[model samples]
Target: MQTPLQFCPRCKKDVAFVAAAGARTCPECGFQYAVSEPPNPGSFPDRPDRAGNPWLQFLTIAGIVVLALLGAGALLLGILFVGCALAFRG
Candidate 1:
């Protein structure tokens, strides 16, 4: 039986879901499968969306830290300029 078309990451095209062995099999490469069952199916999806991705979280925190550092540096520079102007004022 054929189901609605799903996004195929490998094939990079929408393909109908082919129910085989209680998993969604890829109709193109025939290698990847999306096992939507339990009891140790032991198969992974073609396009894995890992929610708890450590690398992604780490990169996001790193980006925020970098932006914070840049803002602090700019603030320090402005304070130094203002202090220098006040000291040299006649």
Candidate 2:
């Protein structure tokens, strides 16, 4: 049995597909493609752990800060509108 040759996008040539150690590499330009193993549904983890991802935490904190600032601005505007209305009435 022989594996079908695939077109190499980088080299722009037809090359034989070779697989070794869960990866496919192009012979011409050395382009690598990782072969992903299918996850076992029964053994899957309950939840993804994001504690190690600091960027996501930073983004979440930044979003909360922005929302808080926007709420403060809206409250300030409301207070100013009430003050202007009271002044105009008097």
Candidate 3:
């Protein structure tokens, strides 16, 4: 089903509600809007599930931390390898 269009307060333009719900960004003015109850009831033809899951949020943070640590470790190892090569050459 297609979602109805909504009016953007900043741009005074009719923007697609489905696109705004997914991105929370206004197509015209680039203004950001929160995905919550519409200011006027029935403004949005349909509501998309915007529920947050705690486990997913935790895993996302954990994944980012793991990636950062791995990147740092790789950088340190690269520096050490270069230093060892230069020292042995001297």
Candidate 4:
């Protein structure tokens, strides 16, 4: 059996190519059909683990150091408050 020719949605005429290659331009009405893949509906892991760039690694380390310094400062403040309370009690 012969395959039926695919019709262009705009002009209702047979399309040139079977698989939508490039833009589908309608000869009759000059309507342009945009050729794009359908979106993948399934969720998938976007990130893959690998050795990152050296500059990126350095920035990440710098961020970690800043966070650690903030945590240390909070701990030091708590210790100073406790020591001040003990000294006042004496």
TM-score of each: 0.44, 0.45, 0.46, 0.39
Once model 3 is optimally superposed onto the true structure by TM-score, how far is the C-alpha of residue 32 displaced, in angstroms?
26
lDDT of each: 0.73, 0.78, 0.72, 0.63
Q: Give the best candidate by lDDT.
A: 2
| lDDT for model 3 | 0.72
Q: What lDDT tens digits, residue by residue, belong to model 2 across residues 1-90?
A: 455688989998999867666577899899988756433354533342453468999999999999999999999999999999999999
Kindly list the per-residue Cα lDDT of model 1 for residues 8-46, writing each as its tens digit.
Answer: 888888887566665677787664675655423565344
TM-score of 2: 0.45
Ranking by lDDT: 2, 1, 3, 4
Candidate with maximal TM-score:
3
Candidate 4 residue 11 Cα shift, in angstroms, is 33
Summarize candidate 3's per-residue lDDT along 1-90 as a digit string, tens digits.
765678888888898743543356776678776865444454554444433456877888999999999999999999999999999999
State which candidate, 2 or 3, has the greater TM-score.
Answer: 3
Displacement of the residue 15 alpha carbon in candidate 3, Å = 10
Q: Where does candidate 3 stray beyond 4 Å?
A: 1-50
Question: What 10-residue stretch in candidate 2 is worst by lDDT?
Answer: 39-48
The window of 10 residues in a row where model 1 has the poorest summed lDDT is: 38-47
Regions of model 4 farther than 4 Å from truth: 1-52
How high a TM-score does candidate 1 get?
Answer: 0.44
